[model samples]
Target: MSYLKCSGMCQLIGGLLLLLLAGCSAGESKFLAGNLNAVNHTSAAINHFSVNGYGGGNVSPFGDGGGMCCVMLPRQWLPGLKLKVEWETDPNPNVRLPALGTDAYRAAYAKHKANYQQHSTIVDLPSYETESLCSLKVHFLSCNQIKLTTACMAYGQPGYPIKEPQVMKEPAVCPK
Candidate 1:
């Protein structure tokens, strides 16, 4: 049978071209949208949080909240993938506000609002590989630390990493 042949340099260039095509195609591939969940391990309750502007619902202290609509993720894991997380915390969940438009309401609202805080940070997303699902799991920790995970598994099952306390009460004070 007839055969094709090339010089060593030509063969190297050909291989490199193939690799370049693969890399470029991977870059062009569209990111898949996935659900988002938030886990709050800190003392404060999370009123809301977002990853790159995709909203995740409220979460109680030491507990997880329900899933949100979506967060976009790559079809495959890429190095240095990061997400900007923004979250609002409720320092006093049980605070009661006075009637609106009243002088007492204005004073109470301002004082109460002072305890609420919003935090933002950039966190690198961990590696995940799954064609069926690519959910973003957010974990809010003490001292304002955060972790993001992607997985198909549920929160409490095996192979899931977050293991928050089941019966712990929210602490009276939250650390800065």
Candidate 2:
């Protein structure tokens, strides 16, 4: 009876170890090359988004030697998907007055109200501007709508207001 119990315990431990190793290997292989059906949203306002899978070339900013951040999209989804990027303009050193009735003007007025009552002085400053930097329009040739399983990076920077992937059956409509 004692020998049987010991053998059973060993078998249990060995099976668990095998399962753990298999899980790790499966996860690693999934990201190597496959269909990607998930989208990683890094922002609360839907400003930033990424997909799993590899890009054709080296395009990842954080990639070590190769392009690890490359994401592959199905040929069908490309028809309506688009990527738009905007960048903040360089800051101006000179201070300027805020436009009246604007949020900034109201804020500054509130802060300096007491000072102005005593010293009769007003101060205003300008804020940096953001402009559209680039836009990428993607188009795919295939008409079939199918899910793609793709690989994702092992580790990546998490964006604010992260969102889970939402699967849509119909094609995406672009915003005007």
Candidate 3:
């Protein structure tokens, strides 16, 4: 009877340890699976705006060899991933509805430019994991409609790099 009790206790402890190990491995795998799809989607969206008399540009990622999985032990448990996107339109040939002259267009352009600058600065600061920054600069060149220039950046992740601004046919709209 003593021998049987000891065996059962050992077996229970071993099973618990195995269960714990499995849980840890699962968590690590989840962390390894970063948001690559999100990056691809962003790239596609930027590419879509490449045409239509718009210029697009992007920046490369920080490190090489794709995105790092477990940069730090704590990261393995709680990954510190980030994605930042910024966009702006040119002031020439305003696209806003009801084209406004040089002065009005310039004012609107300045406003948007300031807004973009502010957003860019804000994103640079440390914040939450999942955050986005989008800015739109629309100029009214005609009675109704405006021209747009968009710029974006995707950073923090290993594989994903900041993308160049794409010439979107439509006005710049930030992704949700």
lDDT by residue (tens digit), candidate 3, 38-87? 11211111111111222224211111112212121112223343323333
Per-residue lDDT of 15-44 in model 1, one digit per residue for the tens? 999999999887654678888997777668
- Model 2: which ten-residue window has the lowest total lDDT? 117-126
For candidate 3, report its TM-score.
Answer: 0.20
Global Cα RMSD, each model: 9.8, 19.6, 16.9
Model 2 spans > 4 angstroms off: 1-7, 27-86, 91-176
Q: lDDT scores for all predictions?
A: 0.81, 0.29, 0.30
lDDT of 3 at 116: 28
Question: Arrange candidates by lDDT, highest first: which order?
Answer: 1, 3, 2
RMSD to native, candidate 2: 19.6
Output the lDDT of residue 154, model 3: 38
Candidate 2 lDDT, 7-118, residue by residue in tens: 7779999999999999987762221222212231211111122232123221111121222334432323323443322211111212254899899988865654433210
Residue pairs with backbone atoms closer than 3 Å in model 1 (clashes): none
Q: TM per model? A: 0.71, 0.21, 0.20
**CA shift of 19, model 3, Å:** 1.5
Ranking by TM-score: 1, 2, 3
Indicate which candidate wins on lDDT.
1
